[model samples]
Each structure stands twice: as C-alpha cells, then as structure tokens.
Target chain A: MPAAIETRNLTKQWGDLKAVDKLDLVVNEGECYAFLGRNGSGKSTTARMLLDFIRPTGGSSELLGGSGSDPDIRARVGYLPGDLNLPRTMTGRDAFNYFGGLRPSGESDVRDSLVERFGLDPTRPVRELSTGNRRKVGLILAFMNNPELLILDEPTSGLDPVLQEEFRDLLAERKADGATIWLTSHVMAEVARVADRVGLINEGKLVKELTFEELRHQATTEITFGFAEPVPPSAFEDVTSVAAVTQDGVDLVLSLNGPVGAVLKRAAELDAIRVETEQNDLDTIFIQLLSGEEQS
Target chain B: MSATLSVYRRWIRDRRLSTVSWTLGIVVIIVATAAFYPSLGSTTASIADGSDSGEAMSSLLGLSSGIDPSTPLGYLWISLYANIVPWTLMALGVALGTAAIASDEDTGALEYLLSGPVTRTQVAFARFAAAVSVLLLVSFLSGLSMVLSLPFFDLTESVTTTAPDGSSTTAPGATVGDIATGTFSSFAVALGLTGIAFLIGAATGRKGITLGGASAVGIGGYVLYTLSSMTSSLDFLTWLSPWRWYVDDVMLINGLTWDVTLPFITATLCLLIGWQAFLHRDLQSS
Candidate 1:
C-alpha cells in the first residue's frame, strides 16, 4: 500500500531533552492510526514534527509522499492542533472562508453541514465561544477541506459527548471516502471504535504497535465462580482461558481472557452455583501498558 | 487569492483598529503642537540666541547651522518633527515589527496559521509588510496633519531674524515638500527600528526579547547622540547612533540629504537577515 505518512527514525532534541526520540512510523493509505500516549509523552511533539512546525534534530518525515515543508503537500493535509488558536477577533465564518480558500477544494456545503452538526454558531467571534465551541471550530477546519490525510492532535478535546460522537461519525464518513487519519487521543473507546492500528508512545519512544483485535485480546476481565463449598485455586489452574486463579472463601476469582466457555464448562462439571463476570474495557489495558512501560 | 496575499490581508484587518488609533493619536499630536506655533515661535528662537543652554537646546531640537529656531521650518522641526514625530513612529514601528511574528507566535496563533497551505517565508514577508504599511500610514497622516494646519497656525509665513552683530538672516516658510521630506525621514528612521525589531523577533521568537532589544537600540541611540552632542569626549561614539546623522542632517530644515537613505538601507538589510533567520529557526512554543 502507498504510505500516507512515513517517518524514519524521526528525532527532535533540545540539548539533553529529547522531545521526540528516534521514531519510525508508517501509516498506509486509507488507514486510521491511533497514536496513544500520556500527557507530555511526545505525542503532540511528534505530530508537530510531522507537520514541520518544528525542525527535527535527526531523520525526516513525508506527508502524502512529499515533504511537509512543501506548501503543495500541506494543501492536501488537514491539521487540527491540540490547542487551536486563531486571531481572537476572527469569527468562525471568517476562519472557514480564509482557511477553506487555501485548498484546491471549494468551500462546499460540507462545511456548513459540519457547522450544523457540531452545533457551532458561525457568527460569534472565537473569544466569545466556549472551549467546546472552539474545539468545534478546529474540527470543522480540519474536516472542512476533505483533505487526503487528516493529522489531528487531541481531536475531541473539550468536546461534549454528543459532539464527540458527531465528530467520530464525521471521521467515519471521511475514512470511508478514502481519507487516512493520524490522530492522538486519550479517549481509548474512541480509538477502539475507529482505529485499525494503535501505536503506544511513552518517554519520546514508540513503545508498541498493535491491531485493535490484538489490543482487545489483551483486555482481560475478572470472573468469579461462587460455590456451596470451598474451591481450591488449583481448580482452574490449568485453564488457559483463565489467566489467574485465586480462592476467596467459597468463591473462585479468575482473571479471564478471551471466552469464558471453558471456565463455564469446568464450573458446571464442578457443580458451580453462580457465575458473575466483571468486564474490562480498553482504558484499563491502555493504563496497564503505560504504567508497565513506566515501571520498566 | 494567493496565500501570501490572504495572510497579508488578514494581518491588516486584525490591526485595523490599532493602526487607526495610532494614526489618529499622531495626527492629534501634530495639530496640537502646531496650534502652539503661532504663540511661541519667536520666543523660542530668541531664547536660543548664543547662550550655552541655548546651544544645548538647539542640539536637543536637532537644529542645523544658520537655522533660526524662530523660522517656520525650524520651529516645526524643533517643536514636533525632530523628536516627537520620529520617536513615536519608531516606537510604533518596533511594536508593529514585534507583532509581525513574535506576538502572534507568542500566542500560538502563528503556528496555527502556518499549519495551513502557506510557507514560513510567505507569512514572514506578509506580516513584515503589514507592519511597515501601518507605520507608513501613521507617518503619512502625521505629515498631512502638519501640512494642512500650517496655514491656520501662521507657519506658512517666512521669518527674518537680525543677528546681534548687525547681520540679518531670512529662512523660508515651511513648504508641503518640506513636510514630505520630514515625514519620510521620520518614517525611514522608524523603518530601521522596525527592521531591528522584526529581526530580533524572527531570530528569537520571543516577545520580551524582541521588544527589549529594539527599544534598547532606539533609546540607546538617543542617549548616545545627546551625550555626544554635549561633550567632545563622546563624539567618537556618535557614529554608532543613527541619530548622529539624523540630528546632524536635520532633514526637515536642511532639506533632503544622503542621511535619509541610510535608514532605508538598514531596513532592507535587517529584513533580509531577519527573514532568513525566521525561515531557518524553530518556532518558540507558546
């Protein structure tokens, strides 16, 4: 596949501080790559480097297979900075007109529709708007051009839940239209819903990359089987479906991975009385990965 | 429209209120000062006649040889053009130049703007041009105010001063051309300061450093020239100050001279150097 965004050992260093360590990333055309990282973990720095806002101390990056420093290449890119700042006096409508005219694409009804979808007032100046509204303007600016690639930093930051869902739907539509997305977001659910691949960055390094399925597989839940009599921890010891087993009086608490079918069968054979399952979401998995990385 | 033009227009629009306010403030000062010309013109000239304090005052007024302070051109030069006009314009220039990149970059707006389909070079030049445009507008309006009010304030009448040694000297009435020369020279000086401010801002991308550096050059130049004029000991240091030639040339009363072109050269060089630095350096995070 043609690469929409590619970086080879990209590094940005300020003396002893490395804002973006040697990172090698490649998001193929039509792929939604979720760049997940904790705060100050080089996510925004990497995005800025990708867009050529900051010069890398080493290596290089290419956008749409062309240099980010090239204006023509950037014209095909829609970027939403984490902290979007326009002139305070500029109205939302003015921003659309000004930024929209820069691209080869015309100012289409898509912009107006996006405005309505985000529930933003086009007439009010940016200073008068709330944080969520400001974020809406940033979103509209990023999505308005229908660019080939969207590089968004904290795309849903400061957004209400409904607007965030609306933004996600917009992202889905754009993705269906063959647009490649490279975004950094703390919302794990949002990432799980849309991303094909997720890259975990920490301490200026790209720590791990995995597909959504693989990430979901790492998401483990706790299942406890209650019984009329005491069950030894060894009851489910040999079961691969149960990652960890512990005895709590007459109950068996199992760290469950994948399906609970095998455990259910084992519990039935053992004449288990009740089965209660506690589900784990992606947020736990992400936190575990980051904390694990920090410990190491 | 081209992105450069669009960016330029947007910058201009953003500063429209500020530019208008600066122009109006300057025009008011010019008219207000001119209003006093009819009342205090001769008295000021008589006070400057051969006293030690008078020579110091002449130096302060930027008076040239044989130019009586009582004459219309001399009076306007001493009262407004020499100090107030150029210094204020220079201050404005410094502010505009800093605003061109440093202020916006400081607020992070410049970074957002650069995220568009515009090159750093385009934005740099667009902003600098906008800053210069505003400075020129203010300078032009100031000169126009002085010229239009010249007749109402009796500054259009030629003055003859008789020397104590029985000799008489006649100085020409202030002309519109003289007003143009004075305004353009003041604008030029301010342009040089503007360039310095732009260069500092571009190279450093910090507002405090840019403002401080440019202001130091301006205020330091004045102090250097003033001290140099007072004593021969500081005369060698005078060459370092742009005011040396500016005050010595007294373009308003002495008419146009080679000194008027130096600031233009300074401005172009600063712009070129600053633009190159801006293109090469990383933007400071807001």
Candidate 2:
C-alpha cells in the first residue's frame, strides 16, 4: 500500500523567499509524524499545500493515492489551520454543523459528543469564547469527523495543561484506531511522546528524519563523578566525544556522547565513585540540529 | 434536493434585518406620496395654462401640454416617469442587490454556503433570484399603494369636458389597465437597476463600493437623459442611459411600448454578464 500522504520535492516560493523548498515528506499509514520547525520555517505553508488551500509553485502532492484537489481525497482529509478564523456571530454548535454538513454521511452526534467532552458551551457565540475555547472549537471540528488522514498545525497552542493531556490521549486513541496523523509543533516533549517519527525542519527545508528510538540513542548523555583524589588529564584521554567537562575540587561533571559502558569503564580506572548518567531531551537534539552541530 | 434551497433560506435569514429596513423605507415613501398626492394635483392644476410653452415645461416635468392636469391619471403619469418611480426603484434595487452578495461574503456566510456540495453557479443564481424577488416585491407594494389611494381623490369618477382645441375629453377614471401599465414600467426600471447593482457587487466584492457605483450609474443616467433632451447634438447619449427607455413622458403618455422593453432586455444582458463574473471569480470571505 502507498503512503497515506506523499509529496515529491515540493517547492513553493513567494517572490524571492522560498516558503517551502524541495520538501520530501512521507507519512505512513497509522503513523503519527511530528514536524518540528520555528516561525517562518514553512510548516504552515507545507500544510496548506498538502490541503490544496494554496497551490505549490513547483512539485506536486498526493493524498491517499489521489490528487490533492480530488473530491474523494478532500472528503477523507481533515485539516486545522494555524490561524483559526471562524465566523464570530455563529454559535459553536452552528459552526461545527455548518462544516459537517459539507461532507456526506456526516454525524451530528459525534460533533455533540466532542463538544461536550471538551466542555464547550454550544449556546455561546464564538465571539464571546476565549482564545483557548475558540481553539477547542476548531479542534473538535477537525477531529469529530474521524477522517482517514488528519493534518493538525500547532494543535495544542492554546490549551490548558489538563486539556492538553486530554488532547494527547485523544490523538493516541485516533492513532490506535489506524488514523494517519501529520502534526506540526514547536514543543519537543509533546512530539517526543506522541510522534512515531520526527522530522526536523529549518529554513524551509527538512534537515533530518529520525525514529523515536534512534532519536533517543543519538541524544547526549550527562555524566557526573566524585573522585577519591584529583584526576589527571591522561586518565580521560581515551574517552572521545566529550561535549563539556568541569571540575569542582574533587567532583567532575562530564557531558559526553558515546557508549555509556565505555565512559563508566574509564571512570573506574580513575577510582571515581558515585557515577550518575542522564540522557538529554529532544530540545537539546533540536537545538543541536538547528545550530548545524548534529551529524547528518 | 432541498440542500440548495436551504442555502437560499439561510441567506435570507442572514439578511432579514436589511431586507426589512429597505422594505419599510420604500413603503413609507410610497405612503407619504399617496398622502401628499391631493396637494400635488391641485398645485399642478392651478399652474396648468395654455400660454405655457410645452417645450420648456417638458424639460422640467417631462409631460406634454396634451395632458389635462385636472385628472389623477395625468398626475400618475407625470409621477411615474419624472421622478417618483425611478428614484424609488433605483434606491431599492441598489440596497437589495448589493447586500445580496457582498454582505454575505463580508460576514463569512458565503464561505459556509460555498463549502457545501452545491456548485458556485447555484449559489450565484439563487442569490440573484432572491434579490430580484425582493426588488419586484417592493415595486408591487408601491403600485398597490397608488392603486388603493386612487378612489379617495374621487379619481374613479367620470367627467366629460371640452379641451382647449374644442375637442371632447375621452380619458376618465383611474382604470386598472392604466395602473397595470404603470406597475409594469416600474417593474422594468427596478429590474434594470437591480441587475446593474448585482454586476457592480460581483465585480467589487464590497458593499459600500457596489451601492455607491450602482447609485452613481443610476442617477448619472438620469442626468444624462436630461442633458440629451436639452441639446439635439447630444441626442445619441440618451441611448446609453437606461432611464431614457423609461422616460416619464413616454411611459405615462404613450403607455407601455416596445421602447420600454429595450431597457429590460439590456438589464437582462447585464445580469447574464454578472452571473458569468460570479461563476469564475475566486471567492474570498473577508
């Protein structure tokens, strides 16, 4: 079977600036792919191109083995834009019903259930809702349809902590049910927890693609050791890829990237005791990739 | 099957306030005119004299000296083409037609409707039809007001007298046939103005600009017609103005003729072009 969503060298340029440049994205079936990028890094532009909201200047995209513009493809795809601007005068229920009515075999009860679960008041006009509630309304509309493919841009930008957790669980449930999800987010922890594979994007280009296990393995490890006596430089000469080393009296804190067993073995030779190691989080990896310090 | 109709229904629901306001404004104007008709008739009769030159007087009133000011039908004729019907129709048409498309898009209601399975042409045609229906209804109400007030002025009574040329007077009573003719002329003028307003709305995608452009075209045409009548050298310019086809003197005195049909036909062509513009243009809800 083909990938759920595929784009081949998709390039979109506005005047002199390239919003999306030669992006090669492959979202597998039932896999939650997280796209990480900074502002003006072409995340939203890529999502817009995927939905055919704006045509790409060059290259092409396909949805479920069909053209992006095909009605069949659109019917199975649910999109939530970065900036959600709905009609202010309509009630939340009315807004959902309006969008739901566009599709065939739409379920009104599903919208109702989602609205209630989010604690959204259907009677209130959208204009009266706070920014977070407004975002909730947009989220409910995008997810309630149970679309075969979901593209959510900054899906948790305005939610409270509890609601954010609920949203993550909802996404987990959807993924378990075999729904392909393409999520773009700046929060590394959120992506680290949910994404099966993460792609780091910067300056409108995809820089790296890593699975969760590979990402964990490639992350830096922090090591701290208290020596029985002062350590000499020759004792640490065999260890390679030491990011930073600091000595406060007899205690040494070394940040390194390599086999943890080798670092421990080398520390034993120095008569160091009380060794501790912790892995670095995705934020460090992301920063390293963005600063051009990571190996390709 | 009923989904398209639901879209139209929602459009009408969205515009209910504006529709009611325009309808009330037109009705109030018609009622005020009906109330003041007696005073107008008496004033015109007192001023009517054989010594007044028909050419100079026609420039101001667009009426020939052949019309007897004592009769209500003659007054109705003057009012129909001179100022009352055209201005009323023009105002109603601009308000209704411009609000039809531009306001929907402005409020984001058009996006909701367009996202449905229905095609763009259906929405355009349905909206145009709805706006035209409102315009025609306003015309019918204005005509009804005039018809209802005909009896209070003793306009239904027949009176025979001699003209200035020593000929027997045959015209009498505010007849239904005469009222129907006036109504048809009003309908044509209203339709023409509405079609022009729709074209402006589709082209501009803005309410204020559409209404302003449509009103300018309408009032500017009337001014052009006046200028054409005064100077024989600029007579060809009259053909460009839709108002020239529904000139007060021509409709009220000459009755409904093929000449008036020209404006209706031109207006239909304009509406067709407007529909095409609406079909091709990309919709952006502001």
Candidate 3:
C-alpha cells in the first residue's frame, strides 16, 4: 500500500536543543499510526513540522505522496493542533465555515453531524467555550472535510470520557472509510483501540515501532494460583511461558510471556482452591516502555 | 472562493464590530474638532499669532509655509489633522498590523490557521490587505465626518484680520477637497507605520515587540523631527523621520506634493521585507 505519511531523517533543532532528531516514519494509507512520546519529547514538534507549521532544520516529510508545504497537498489533509485556538470572536459555526471553505469536501451535512455528535453549541463565540468545547470545535473542523489523511496532535486532550469515546467511534468510522490517520495521544487505551500500530519516540528519537499485538506481547499476563497451604514461587519456573513466579501466603502469581496453557496445567496440578489472572494495561506498558528507553 | 479570499473575508467578518467602533470613534473626534472651529477659531488664530515666530511652537504645531492657525483650515490642521488624526491613525495602524499576524500567533491561532489548506503567503498577504482595508475605512469615514461638519461650523466662510498699522491679511476657508488631501496624507503616514508594524509583527510574531518597534518608528520619528527643528545637530538624522516631510509639506493646507509619495514608498518596502521574513521563518507558535 502507498504510504499516507512518510518522513526521511526529519529533524528540527532549536539552538542547543534538538526538538526532533534524525527520524524516519512511514504510516501507510488506511493505517492508524499512533505516535507515542512523553511530554516535551518532540511529538507535537514533529506534528508541527509535518504540517509545515515549523520548518525542519534537516530532512523532510510528505503527506499523501506530496510535500506538506504544498497547499494542494494540505487540501487533501485534515489537521488538529494540540492546542486549538480560533479568533476570539469566532463562533463554532464560523470556524467551520471559514476553515472548511478552504477545502472542497467540507459538506455542511458532515459538519452538522459532527457538531451534534460532539454536543457542541454552534452559536457561542469560541472564547466563551471551555477547553473541551473548543477541542470539539477543532475536532469537527478536522473531520468535517473528510480529507484523505488526518493529522491530529493530542486529539482528545480536553475531552470528557464520553466525548473521548465518541471521538474514538468517529475515528473508527473514518478508518472504516479508508482514511489514513496519524495521531499522537497520551490516552493509551484510545491508542490501543484505534491504532493498528504505534511508534514510540524518546528525546526526539524514534525508539521503537510495533503493532498493537506486539505491544501487548511485551505486556506480560500475571496469573495468581491459590492452594490450601502456602506455596513456593518455584512451581511454575519450569513452564516456558512463565517469565517470573512469586508466592503470597496461599497463592502463587506468575508473570506469563506466552500462552497460559502450561501455567494452567501446572496450576491445576497444584491448586486446591482458586485461580485469577491479571493483564498489564497499556498505561503501565507505555510507562515501562519509556522508562526502559530512559534507562538505556 | 480561493483560500486567500476566504481568509481575508473571515478576518474582516470577525473584526466587524471593532471596525465599526474604531470608525465611529474617529468620526466623533474629527466632527467634534470641526464643530468647535466656530467658537474657537478666533482664539486659535490669536494663539497662532502669539506663537507665530516662536520656533518651538511652530515646530510643535507643524506651522509651515505661512499657515495661519486662525483660519478654518489652519485651526483644523492644528487641532485634528496635524497630530490627532495622523497619530490616531498611526496607533490604529500599528494595532491592525500587529493584529494581522502577531496577535493571532500569540494565541496560537495563526498556527491553527496555517494548518489548513491556505499557504502562509496567502495568509500574510490577505491579512495585510484586510488590515489596510480597515485602516482606509476608518480614514475615509473620519474625513467624511470632517467634510460633513464644515458648513455647520462656518469653516466654509473665509475670515479677514486687521493689524494696528492698517495692514490686513485674509485666511481662506476650508474646502472638501482640502479635507480629502489632509485625510489622504494622514492615511499615507499611518500606512507607513502600519507597514512597519506589519513587517515587525510578521517577522517576530510578538505583540509587544511589534507594537514597540513600530511605535518607536512613529513616536521616535516625531520626536527626532521636532528636536531637529530646534537644533542643527540632529538635522542629519531628521531625514529618517516621516514627520520631516509631513510637517514640512503640511499637505492639509498647501495641497498635495511629490513628498506624499514618500510614505507610500516606505510602506511598500516594509511590506516586501516583512513578507520575505514571514515566508522564510518558522512561526512563533506551533
């Protein structure tokens, strides 16, 4: 498939600081690539460079096979900045009309649907709207045009959970329509659900890129096995799928790296009471991934 | 419509209320000054006579080429056109120029606007045009207000004065064409400042810096020109000041001159410099 977004050694430098170092990224068409990074880790800077808001000191980027600097290329793209700001006097409706008018596909019907979906008041001046409402306006502006590629930065920062979920649903709907999505969000669950793949960046460097399945694979499953009597932590050590094993009074907790079949077999052989399993969520995984990068 | 037009239209639409407010404010000031010309014309003329040979007062009031401050045109020039109108326009022009890009950039609004289909070039040019349009609008309305107040205030009637030696002098009344000339010259002065402010704002995207830089040009130029009139030491530096030509030409009463084109030329240079800076640099916010 053609790449929807691609960067070749994309770099941006500010005096002594390297905002975005030599980086390579490829997000294929119809793919939802979630760019994950810590705060001030250059995710937003990268996004800004990709959209030509700032020029890279080195290298270049392209969207939909064209330079991002080209207006015609940007016309086929939708973008949402991390902090959405409009003219203070502009109403939500005005933002839609003004921003939407630049592109050919800003159908009023799509705009109306988005406004309703996000539960935004169209008539209030943007200055009066709360951050979440302003974000809704930004989201609507980004999605209203139905562009071929969507570049969103911290897309759900100020949204309530309900609205965040709604936004996820909208992303899903757009993904179903084959629109390429390149987003950077701290909401790990949102990334887990919507992004087919994720790229982790550390201090301006692209550290690792992995499919959601690979990310989950890095997340070990913790299972606890209970026995009538205190159990030693070494019982599941022989099981190839168990990475680590520990004991708590009458239960044994095992961190599994693979299928639970062998651990279950071992647990059944020894357990006289109960069994429980816990999965490491992406939030923990995201932290671990970054902390690991920091360590090295 | 094209992206440039769309951006331009939105800028004008969003500023509609403020635009009306500024225009009305200018109109009220210009008209009120003209209205007072009837009651204060004689006193103002005498004041002009009192300061007639005082070089400092002449420089301050921009009395040039035998302008009698008692005349309708002279009083209007001293009261409104000389300082108030051009100063007000310059202040407003700086504001509009800063608003063109710097104000929006301060709030990250410019970055958001740039992320759309519009090119930075389109935004820079469109916003500069929009700002110029508003400045022109306020200028036209204020001039119209002065013109409308002329007949009501006896500004159309010429006045004659007699000296103790039986010598007499007559100062001509104000005319609609004079008002146009004054307003246009004042606009040109303000436009020059606006272009400077726009250039600074586009180059820096910092409101304080843009306002300060352009304001320095306007106020500093005036001060430099005024001081240079009092001494010969600063005369060489006076050439850099817009007030040098403005007060010397005093287009309000003397009619239009070739010097009027100086401000326009300065404004074009500013636009080109500012545009090049904006086109090449990274935005302040993003």
Strongest candidate by lDDT: 3
Stretches > 4 Å off in candidate 1? A224-240, A245-253, A258-275, B50-58, B64-67, B165-167
Where is model 3 more than 4 Å wrong at Cα? A224-242, A245-254, A259-276, B50-54, B64-66
RMSD of each: 2.4, 5.8, 2.3
lDDT tens per residue, model 1, A1-296: 99999999999998999988999999999999999998998999998888888999999999999998888988999999898888878999988998898777856798998898888899999868889999999999998988899999999889888888888888998999999999998768877778999999998999989999999888888998899999888988888788889889999999987678888899999999998988787888999888998899
lDDT of 3 at A22: 93
DockQ of each: 0.72, 0.17, 0.77
- C-alpha lDDT score of every prediction, in listed order: 0.88, 0.73, 0.89
| 10 residues in a row with least lDDT, candidate 3 chain A | A263-272
Candidate number with the higher DockQ (2 or 3): 3
Between the candidate structures 2 and 3, which one is better when assessed by lDDT?
3
DockQ agreement of candidate 1 with the native complex: 0.72
Q: What are the per-residue Cα lDDT tens digits for candidate 3 across B1-286?
A: 9889988988988889998998888888888888888789777767676444566677788775557777888899889888999999999999999999999998899988887778888998999999999999999999999998999999999989888999998878889999999999999999999999999998998999998999998999999988887888999998888898888888998899998898888888888899999999988873
Model 3: native contacts recovered, as a fraction: 0.87
TM-score to native of every candidate shown: 0.94, 0.74, 0.94
Q: What is the TM-score of chain A in candidate 3?
A: 0.92
- lDDT for A42 (candidate 1): 96
Considering only N, C-alpha and C atoms within 3 Å, which residue pairs clash in candidate 2?
B81-B248
lDDT of 3 at A238: 84
Per-residue lDDT over A169-235 for candidate 3, one digit per residue giving the tens place of the 0 to 100 score: 9999999999999999765777788999999998999998999999987887888888999878777
Output per-candidate TM-scores for chain A, rounded to 2 decimals.
Answer: 0.92, 0.89, 0.92
Q: lDDT of model 2 at residue B133?
A: 75
